[model samples]
Target: MSDFNSSVNLTMTINGVPRVIACNPADMLCDVLRSAGYTEVKKGCDTGNCGVCTVWLDGVPVPSCSVFAGRAEGREITTVRGVEKEATEFAQFLVAQGADQCGYCTPGFTMMVLALKRELKSPTETEIRHYLSGNLCRCSGYEGHLRAIIKYLEASHE
Candidate 1:
């Protein structure tokens, strides 16, 4: 007799909504999220090198590519869209400061920064850079990104 446990049913909260999905043992969270309509979770360098697929797993920032969908079965998943309201001001700052070039990696950067904002009341330049090292950008060259993050950090203190 064949085992029926190869694929598992996942019941997780996504963007504050209860979500139910089925995933195979080897399916990555990124693939499952995209399948479930969370396109904001980008698929960049699916080997976990790029942070484009970054998402919040129970309030912690993690690369969806490195995580299996089964791992999120009962946790809360927050994509960039989930935190759009919280990251809007920071996103605008990046745009106004000319930091959002090309815009491909902006969602990932925004998501990661939004999580950082939740964890830190204020972050130093070095800390910002360190925290953002995972997400790679080629168009903006990270100049505008760094500046915008600094400005966001400063503004939140006021």
Candidate 2:
């Protein structure tokens, strides 16, 4: 009989849908997601240290770079591109507030913002900063980001 330890195809839920993709055991979630067309889940450091690779796995935000495709089997992965309602609000807010210059880090920031909005329907300025502490922005100071977040919360209330 075979050892049966070899890697096999893994299936997982991405953005509230099911996806069964063939991948090696060594393949990371980021790679699988990208290949499956969820390119929004970026690969920043690939070390799990940077929050850039963050994704909500069953409602808990985690680093996709550190996760294996098999590990994500049967789990719900929410990428920025998959969920656009909240994300669009964030993007619109960023543009209106002049926060997304260069736009390299907006995806990551948007993910964190989604998490914050889930937890706090309306977050204060300090709360926004505290929640977004994990995501790193290479350009544009936090002033615009803060403005965007605050404005989004305000709009949600109205």
Candidate 3:
């Protein structure tokens, strides 16, 4: 019912700054954001199985690769870069726990962890595991990630 070749202009608040980007109606938000210079939104399993392209759509984390770009019009989208300060602090914990290897999954993992912190406040280990189940890591075996999350959460509450 719509022209596939046509580009649509979408205005989204990215990292607290309003940006207008042109993308095809069928373009995925991950592709659009990356093209618009938000490379922090990585592209992994474009089918949404992998959480590599997670971004906060209006303060809720969702897989950008599974979302249509046009759906983000006039909405606020927060990538990992949007929470640089908190992410940086959390990254320290990640490194100390040896969870920052490869880094391909770090951005999305960070977004999910940050969301967990905000939403859960003080989550149990099982809750943390459940919350992060969508994110998969090929390296580190996730033990390091779990340690890093526990450490980060402990530090945050102090």
Top model number, lDDT: 3
Runs in model 1 lying further than 4 Å from the true structure = 1-5
Runs of candidate 2 with Cα error greater than 4 angstroms are 1-6
lDDT of 3 by residue, 78-121 (tens): 99999999999999999998888899988998999999999997
Compute the lDDT of residue 72 as modeled in candidate 3.
Answer: 95
- Residue range with the least summed lDDT across 10 consecutive positions in model 1: 1-10
In angstroms, the error of model 3 at 23 is: 0.8
**On a 0 to 100 scale, what is the lDDT of residue 135 in model 1?**
94
**Which residue pairs collide, candidate 1?**
none
**Which 10 residues in a row give candidate 3 its minimum summed lDDT?**
20-29
Task: Please give the lDDT score for candidate 2.
Answer: 0.79
| Whole-model lDDT values for every prediction | 0.85, 0.79, 0.92
When sorted by TM-score, best at the front, the candidate numbers are 3, 1, 2
Q: Which is better, 1 or 3, measured by lDDT?
A: 3
lDDT of 2 by residue, 1-158 (tens): 43234656787888778878877756788887888788777777788766788888888787888887777877788888777887887799889988878876777678888888778866667878888887877787789889888888788778
TM-score of 3: 0.97
Number of backbone collisions per candidate: 0, 0, 0
